[model samples]
Target: MEVSTSKELQAFGETSIEKIIEELREECEIEKHLPGGGYLHMSDELPYLVIYRNEDEDIEKGMDRATVRLILSEASFLIIGNKDFEGYQRLMFCLSEAMSSKFKSFLIIEVFAGDPESRKFKIKGPAGKLSTTIKVLQEQLDDVDSGYRALQLGETEVQDTLQRQPEGKKPLLDLPQLKDSGCLLLGVEVPPVYRSKEGEDYPVFFRSFKDDFVVALHKTIFHFIRIQTSSGVKSYRALGQKHLQEKVKEIDRQLAEIETSYEFLWLVSPANIRHIKDTFFETNYEQVLNYHYRLLPFDPDVLKRRLYNLKLEDVDDPALSYIFREKREELDLQISMLSERGSDSFFYNSMMLFGKISNDLQREAETILKEVNEKEDQDFKSIMKAEDFKILANREFDYFREQDKNFSSKVHVREDVNILMVSRGELYLPSDYKLNANETHALIQHEIGTHVLTYYNGQQQPLKLLSIGLTDYDTLQEGLAVLSEYLVGGLTANRMRTLAGRVVAASARMHGADFQEIFRLLNKDYNFTPQRAFNITSRIMQGGGFTKDISYLKGLVQLKKHLEEGGELAPLLSGKFALEHMPIINELKERRVLTPVKLTPRYLKSEETRKKLGKIREGIPLSQLINA
Candidate 1:
């Protein structure tokens, strides 16, 4: 069986059915533009054929674009605008016949506009013959409909005539003509909820069913293929657009190019954190301290102008366009935040980039705080100096280098960095960095095992954007990093409480608590030592009340929920992306747009870690994760 086909058309510019047949003979994927606004896209020579008749509804208006997205993603032959024009029916018949003969079994689904109310998906075909396929389609479509009203699908024999009629249009190909070619054709009427139909607005039902509407269409096609066709596709994602337009590729390249121009977090980070901390301590925590930031490389206004110039309208794939659009929006916000640094607006922008603390999250933080502090007096662990830790970090890098010769990871010790961080593949450590025994292992897993490993994994993918990261990916990044700490059997109670304390600090700051007040809350109330409390308070207070520290616990909570829901942990490590982007990630993987991860963290291979992973998958809570 042919598993792949080239997009470079053998027919060149010919739109004739004879030329189309010659091209389809090889089962090669071909796309052609017809004379009268018609289009034909075949992902490969699959038995599934999807037809969209463009009559009264223009492609610009409602579900037409979404229908196009649906067609491009599926392994089907899509013929648009052909049913309305004269002489095109012959092409549909010939093409359908050729494909049916090639595959031995074929299925055709023609999507038309349905009534605005009562039925969301209305099927028209031989009710008895297509019963199984229709039943599966109905079940999936029903799952698609949600909210106040339910739109169930039913079959009508009346609309099942061999020939289709459109208002003021040439007659569509009859069933006998299609039978000469050997294919089962079905017509599906979709409610034009996405369109407002000229003047009269659609009812409130449109709003209810529009969410994930295109995805629902995708599910319908996937089910029909499984139930009635010869295609062996196992996932709805196999129906996604395999060939991306050049415009989409250019936009992805441009966005990633802009992203590589500067690192956002490094800009927001203070250049004089240690100096400021010393001055604050010398004043006995009475003085209101001011923070300083690293100088930016590019003009913020110029960057904003460059970002807004990206034409999201040109990219047709909704999924790809959304990813690019989201990244552009995030970059704009980060640029603005950098420009507004040392002001109240900076704090607000930071909160927007990384979300603020929720009541439930704050409560979870409090619970962990209460549980951990009830034990014996807290004491710092036997610490390792920054110089010694750098040697160990390099040793870890060497191990990875041995596995993949091209792996070029490095470790650097500098007073300029905050504790330890990996940026652009190089791990940085503060000159005065110190770590306890348990922390020594935990930090390695958190940084090298998770962050650096994913960085290189993303590097192997075709889309360089994955290497940089998707927008708002920090939540999952931190969550996966923290989880790695546990997987390696190095998660200490003190570390868990410290994470909880960070959340408390964020919640307190959002509620208008000053630095001194928050420090005292952690130091005196939560029993964290003064120096430790100062570190926590300082993180939340940096860059004029930054609240990103809240993400540590928030990411942990989100990750736990994902694992319990049967979400795969391996995909999260595939690249830096949020937990919510799982569907998008899986879809891309099915489309062959993403490569397999280059390296698996050592912790994931351990028999001991596998036991801990089982509990996490079974829905263990965050505070109890330390014990796992």
Candidate 2:
């Protein structure tokens, strides 16, 4: 091994800085399995280094910068001032030497800082096959040299000359344009312009951009499209502008039909929810358990196969691929979970599917609601009948539709609905249920503003999966729903307590607590009304301990944290989606795989509502909210 340093290095351009950063990113990404049964971490936190065990102690953030030691048994390493060049080099050298003497293939040449005339440099290598680090560094160094020459000739002059060239003489593409195109074009050949989809043979040009790479870029873009000799340059196509639009339309059409065939919640829910009210009120737990679910109206296997046949792998766009693949898996899980709904098979299956409520969450709920006022406010005491709710819902629905004529979802009261449910563009409410002003506002935001708005926005997209939903959409969907309630100032302590109660009930059921036992706990210990306790208990105990209700508070916690961390709520409103899918959603938007949001929840438009949301950025944990 050899190492060298320079007192003065060349000034690097933005591209060089970016490439050097990229090299660091790649270097830090390496995860080596330790002999001590752990892995090294290139943590994103400051100091840019960490160590983590395979099963535990994988603390990801907030590592101490002062620490500078490697513990083999503990699987940790600390290096100070990792962001700086000397520190980075020393860290890497320390890391490499500390790992094992047997490992020797290491090389790194880096430019840390300074202008073109005077920059710092460090180089170390075995003088054999050049590693990726060395290659990127060398390329950057070459760019600096080229940059110096260009500066002498005046970069503006060269650029102006290039711009003044005739249309035929113009370069096929620019670097920024290539990056935005989302196609891997480095070293690889591509057609200058994607004119047709037809196949034809065309001659190809191979060029070496040894120096003056930017100048050579123009000639390389158009001539290198032909790779295989058999196919013409036009055969290797980027998504044409017209073709992308058409593809989006096709995806939209395909997704629109999913909800019709798969009514996810309705299918998975016990068909007897409406009729079981009396039985639940009467405390007939055994009788309730004996009640059968309605037979699945649609074929599960056929639906799974249909979702599978979506060919998400063929999408060619990473964002689109991720969206479709997740939708397919989500639909598949819904189908499989539905197969066990309302039967003894449901409970364990649900645990497997959605996981049991954690003790910490239950504890948090208890702490959060311990002091909340459960009484209805006198000023908002007037309750609206189910008919009244329908009027309000219709008005909200009309306003929603007015945003887009294509928004055709409607609202109505149904004898069978337990409270409120939105499915396939229809908002259903229980026939006899009445809501006070608070409840009315909460329901509108939760159902119409959130569920309905996302549905239509998703429908408007080329990819219907937004309408169909990604896997684990419930967590983010419910989180955003609960978040909407908070935004509208309807997320009261009592409402939050109810959510916490559901988690406690779900937790109790998961631990094998019986219905009456769970109900008793909620009613007596949790201070819930007998009716409210029974409702919470029955929801968790039904369909063999359905745990979806836990999302209310848990989702709130997650969403609140997301917002506090500067997450945007508008992207979430783009469709029925999840928190983890934000990256894919943003990526798709960047690539224009998905369109910009057209519909926003009405409450989100309010300055007061936004202020409420902003205040919650510090986070309104169930305990904090209840106390507030």
Candidate 3:
């Protein structure tokens, strides 16, 4: 017999049974060479042709032993290939149409292993299209009740069979049913489609096809095309233009949600307190270069290249553009503000704090380096062989290396700068820094327990912005890190002093002291070494601002007050919790979920001076553990 031409098929109103079958045949042949072979192999096509030619073969030979058995076997391959949504829909329509016209009655049992509602195709209109085909078949067959019973039985069997499969292994088939007596289409939905929000539409389609020859037709069609239409091959690319458009809309919605949440938080957070507390810090001059280099390790050239590539400034959405511009402006304003302030502020104070912290850490590191120098340190110059300054420098290098595994001398740290810097992770020393067993526990509670725990937990959330860190999240993070230290019994007088020194330095920078002045004051008045004073002053003045310096004492004081008032800490650790994003927290709290409360600056009034004076007068130490 002459095969139908493509022209002839197209002429059949694009929906004629003969035309669809012919198109299916052509499509199947084309799909064969493309990876996993398609439905309608030569053997299956031959049987299909024979069955079409002699529909009376079943009546003549009986259902059990018929010449059409070869064709039925071949047809099974086509059904298997229809596992994909498009293939499944096409095959179901074809078979349902064929059965409705040819058979007196037929039964179909579609057994979806998972929830049918959850097994929807990502392709739009698939469920509806398939349901229409099933309705056409059901109306023609007039055996809806029998079809429903068969469907239930098939579903049960499929569930039972799937339960027996080994964990992680795919079940070969969901369920098996007798064709003609009861045809069954059984399979598990692909995980992506199963979990997708679009899945809500699937139950309606599943229910529509609940009985008789429409079910049988669904089974036959699925059996025939399963192999060709695997979900893996169809998921990412098979999406129609309409579906892609819908996805774009969905992405926009999510972005809107994030922005709205951010705005709401901004409105509710204690912005006034931060602005008022910002008045004291002074900038340091000598450490200014170091501070700038430390905060931003990447070279200007490299940063420019990345910024150009990111096109972050070119964002089209007005709201997002506004936010981007605002952030840049804020950073620039901060830099300008620090530069404009004279030497009276905490810039020098911060420099002093950095110098003290660095020197103190360096001293501890030197002790260890000396031991290494006395023993295995012969390969390299011994710590004893080096001058004190050289020993301190080496200690700094080693300490930075131990802290950041990804630290590279080439890209991250420049030899020209003569300093090692780390952008991420907490930095601490061992003596005034090294934790004893109890202190170690406190450090863990502070570092890993508070900071890292919140970080990882935030990562578990759906929003990338939350995980990336919010604008004012620093205040809460530091406060909580300090609180955890207090809870674990690690808060001490020395720690309080260190924190106070940070505040004093930060305040001095706000008053515009240069690095030399800050270093001298810290060394002469505060009893910090020259090196320690230099490091601290550099940290405060270098980044063109002293933002980080103020947080240490302020965060600790706030945490102390909170804990003293019996505030719960668990809400602060929630995945969705954010200090900057306070309105969302309020919303969550309103909904009866635990969430972090808004964090306000500790020194809104002459709060810093008050705390400092209180510490001096009490002689009981600045940091007071609430429990103690």
> Which of the numbered candidates is closest to the native, going by highest TM-score?
1
Error of 2 at 458 (Å): 1.0
TM-score of each model, in listed order? 0.84, 0.61, 0.34
| Model 3 segments more than 4 A misplaced | 1-439, 529-535, 563-566, 575-580, 588-622
lDDT of 1 at 504: 90
TM-score of 3: 0.34
lDDT of 3 at 302: 42
- For every candidate, C-alpha RMSD to the true structure in Å: 4.8, 20.5, 21.3
lDDT of 1 by residue, 336-399 (tens): 8888888889888888899878888889999999877533433655677788787878878887
**Model 2: ten consecutive residues of lowest lDDT:** 65-74
Residue 388 displacement in candidate 1 (angstroms):
2.8
| Candidate 2 clashing pairs, residues 3+ apart or interchain | 9-119, 11-115, 11-116, 190-225, 368-623
Candidate 2 similarity to native, TM-score: 0.61
Better of 1 and 3 by TM-score: 1
What's the lDDT for residue 259 in model 1?
Answer: 81
Model 2 residue 457 CA deviation (Å) reads: 1.0
